[model samples]
Target chain A: MKLTDTFKTAIIGLKTNKTRSALTMLGIVIGIAAVITMNSIGAGAQNLILSRVASMGSNNIFIEPGPWSKRMEKGSMMQSMVEEANITSLKREDAIAIANHPLIEMAAPFTMGVGRIVYLDVDKKSSYSGITPDGQKINENNVILGRDINEDEVKSMAKVVVLGFTLKEDLFGEEDPIGKIIRIQKTNFRVIGVMEEQGVQMFQNMDTYAFIPITTTQKLLLGTDHVKWIIAKAWDEDRIDEIVSDLRLLLRERHSIYNPSGDLAKDDFKIMTQKETADILTSVTGVLTMFLSSVAGIALVVGGIGIMNIMLVSVNERTREIGLRKAVGARKKDILNQFLMEAVTLTFLGGVIGILLGLTFSYLGGVILGNMLDLKWSAPLSLDSILLSAGVAIVIGLVFGIYPARKAAELSPIEALRYE
Target chain B: MAKTTEVIEVRDVRKEYRNGAIKTDVLQGISLKVFEGDFLAIMGPSGSGKSTLMHIMGFLDRPTSGSCNFRGKHIDSLSDDELARIRNKKMGFVFQMFNLLARTSVLDNVRLPLFYSGLKGKEELELAKRAIELVGLTDRSHHLPNQLSGGEKQRVAIARAIVNNPEVIFADEPTGNLDSKSGQQIMDVLQKLNNQGHTIVLVTHEKYTAEMAKKMILIKDGKIVYNQKVDHRRFAKDGFEK
Candidate 1:
């Protein structure tokens, strides 16, 4: 028989028992839907993280005051606590040294603190960062109003601050707040500039910080001569590795941790390039997606078993039909093909419906998440995942259909015809 | 007029079925011959093994200890697929239950055997229509089996049997489930096909039904007790009596 004829016969058989066929397809439908939903959501999350990391500036690097292994090694809680007290070892001079390197374009040493800012009747609590003049350039901060802090401001330890977009909105709310004085802690500082709006990154709202000159912050606000971390940009992307090595050499020389064999555990500081951070984020999300999809795959297995169970029952119910076909000149292979085609058709229909349902759910989910996280969310429908899921469904049909098809083919026409 | 070509020839055929420790001999070395254009009826009581012998003659069951031939070719030596090909191309069957596929239209029911005939769609339909017309079911081709009366259902079965233009048709109690009127209509159709030169082997327990055939064989306890030509005068005369 022609393949089309076999498929047609299979279709007729399924159409005769429409309710039973649909019920048999339920497991596969849920399984495929779960798989597609997880795949799209996982891809969307990875894309969001990648774009956020990219927006933070791919050519930039971060240098923090701690050994690389301090956070990674187990049972180092006491060691990290002791190290945290002396973390003030990285001074502003080290940032200047790294900035002077030919491979480095700009460097800004900064520290973070949370404080309340009072402007008129509005007093809001927000995070504040101390950065130098070059911090605006390295962090991609654009001044929408007024001027950024200059070299003279840093030299004079000027009591001026730049408000983040969200902070400006909170205190002023559609009013011009540039040059307005805001009280930070016990000191009063004039807002010199308002930074352009930067959206959420890594789940943290980027438009919420107020920036002040590092010199003023260290001298008057923090009362510390040391900075917490240094952010730097490379002159060119290709020279990032060279600039990182130069910073590592300069920081090690200045900090005087001269264990020169480059054992990262013994080093007093950690330098991480933007690429390294992105790679770490990718790996973390990748593992998380894999684990989640595997849990969803369990549903697919259950669905396949359901298909097999229903196929066996169908074969039993249609024994006389099988016998009639055989008596009327149907070969064993024909019988097998008919039943197998029925199974494939069932799962294929289920897969198509599942994909549509999965896509719908994913789109709705993306919209809800986008609203909650305050980011633009797109439904991530990867063609590869769709194709893979379809392939899995077909293979499931074939594998599960085999035993029942064989049972049908192996039946004797006499016995089957005689079967009540 | 007797046709010289033998459609089926069975020799010393024996069929024994085993169920674990119990063994029952269904047919003990039975032999028979059915020629082309022959309308032969095999009659016996229940459990007489006539059905088993008919099954073996039709290549539906393999005899345990003898040879069966179709058109001078040994059937026991043929593979299962080969047997299926022979059944599809040269043999047709009608069952006592009027074994039309449930929920299937009369046209499609008649067209079932032609699916294996490798005939193109239009040609298969044309042939199916001719067979349905032959069985006087042209107006009822689109009706399902459940929607038709017992006689119409049996006619649909007859149409299905002849759609492939098989050289022989094996009918096992083709009218067994129908009333006398429906049974007489089924016998008339079979008689018309036999007259048109198609060999038919019918299995039945009714003596009147057996008398409609050109030859009759009576089997008792797995052995043929009577094999002879039917005397047309001994049976009741009907309007279309030969």
Candidate 2:
């Protein structure tokens, strides 16, 4: 029979029993929609993480103290002496040493502490970061008003601070706060700079911080000389790996640790590049996407089974019609083609509906998630996902449509015609 | 005297159907010949194996140990697809229940056989229209089977059967489900087709319906008991009630 005629016949059969066909297609619709939604959400999350990581500056590297077990293993008296000799740990001297490397562009040693700030009638708790003047350069902290902390200020341990945009807005409102004095834990400090509005990065509001000179924070505010972390920028992106190895070796030598290849957990420090962080995020998101898609794939399989079950029922119900068609001149292949075509058409229609619904739901879901988490939500409907869904729908139809079509085709004309 | 050309020939056909370990012999070595342009009826009581013999002769069932030929070609050994092709091109069938497809227009029902015949486009439609006209159902071409009367449904079935212009038409209990008036009308239509030189084979237990045929055969059990040319005087009045 002509393929067009077979398709027309199949369409007519489905049209005649609209409710049954729709019910059969429901499984497929939900299955495809779930697959699309899961994929879209997974891609959106990965993209959000990627953009956040990118905002951190690819050439930047961070160095921090290692696990506390390594530090506590020393005797209590020795630990106290080690703490007092902050230059022996991650300190300003190490930052100066790293900054001297030809491949290193700049390095800033920083320490963080929580402090209550009072400006006239307003008082609020905020994170106070102490950084050198080069911290602004390495961390890409752009100043929109006044000036940044300078070397002379750091050397004198001057009580001066830079307010983040949100901090300035909260304490001084619309008034210029660059020359104003704010009390940090009851210590008065002159505001040297107000940072530009940078918004959120890595899930933290960068606008809510107050920055001071590292020496001032370490010696006066924090009452310690040890720095918490060090930020460094690379002169060339390609030399980052070499610079990291060199820095690691230099730190190991400076700390008098032999066998640098030994267990890294025993090391007193940790160094990380932006690429490593990005790779970890990618793998994490990849696994999440796989896990979610598999869960949705189960729905597709159930839907396929539904199609098969309904098709078998249809074959049984139309036994007499099969007999009549055979009697009129329908070959076994004709019967098979008709039933198979009906299944494919049913699933194809369901797939189209599923794609549209999936896109809508994914967009809605993205909006909700974006609002809750305060991140940009772009609809992640990739062409590969759309095509893969369509392919899966067709395959499910063919695989599930086979058994019933075969049964219908293999029926004997005499027996089928005799069936009540 | 000129000899008639044989359209279907059945020789020593035996059919046995097995249910588990039990076997029932439906047709025991029955032999028959159907000629072109002849209206022949095979009459028997229920379970006499007349329907089995008719099924074998119509190529719907295969004989266990005998050979059947159609138009001088041995068809018992033909593949299912080959047999289907011959059925599509050379045979027509009308059933007791007037098995028209439900929810389908009468015209599409008639055009179904031609779908596999490879007839293209307008030509297939014209042939279907001619067949519908032959069955006198042209006005109800677009109506579904449920909208038609019993006689009209049978006529539509007949139209479907002849839409491919087959060489022979098989009617199995054609009026078994119809009233006397409708049955008479069905018999009249069969008779008129026969008069127009179409070969027809009918299977029924009604003596009045068999009386309208040019030749008749009576079967008892699995074997034929009487085979004779009908006497025209018995059905000359054209109505069974008279």
How far off is each candidate at the interface, as Cα RMSD in Å? 0.9, 0.8
Q: Quote the lDDT for A13 in model 2.
A: 87
Candidate 2's TM-score = 0.91
Local accuracy of candidate 1 as per-residue lDDT tens digits, A79-173: 65467555877788888888888878888898777788899999989888888878877767788888888888888999999998999999999
Kindly report the root-mean-square deviation of model 1 from the true structure over all alpha carbons: 3.0
Per-residue alpha-carbon lDDT of model 2 for B1-242, expressed as tens digits?
15989999999988899999999988888888999898889999989888888877778878898889999878656988888888899999999988888899999999999988889979999999999999789999999999999989998999998888788999999989988788888888888788787899999998878888889999888888999888862342367562
Considering the two chains of model 2, state its CAPRI-style docking category.
medium
RMSD, one per candidate, in order: 3.0, 4.8
What 10-residue stretch in candidate 2 chain A is worst by lDDT? Answer: A68-77
Looking at model 2, the pairs that clash are: none
Candidate 1 accuracy as TM-score? 0.94
Q: Candidate 2 regions off by >4 Å?
A: A67-89, A112-128, A156-158, A170-175, A181-190, A215-228, A260-263, B233-237
What local lDDT score does residue B241 receive in model 1, on the 0 to 100 scale? 33
Native contact fraction per model: 0.69, 0.73
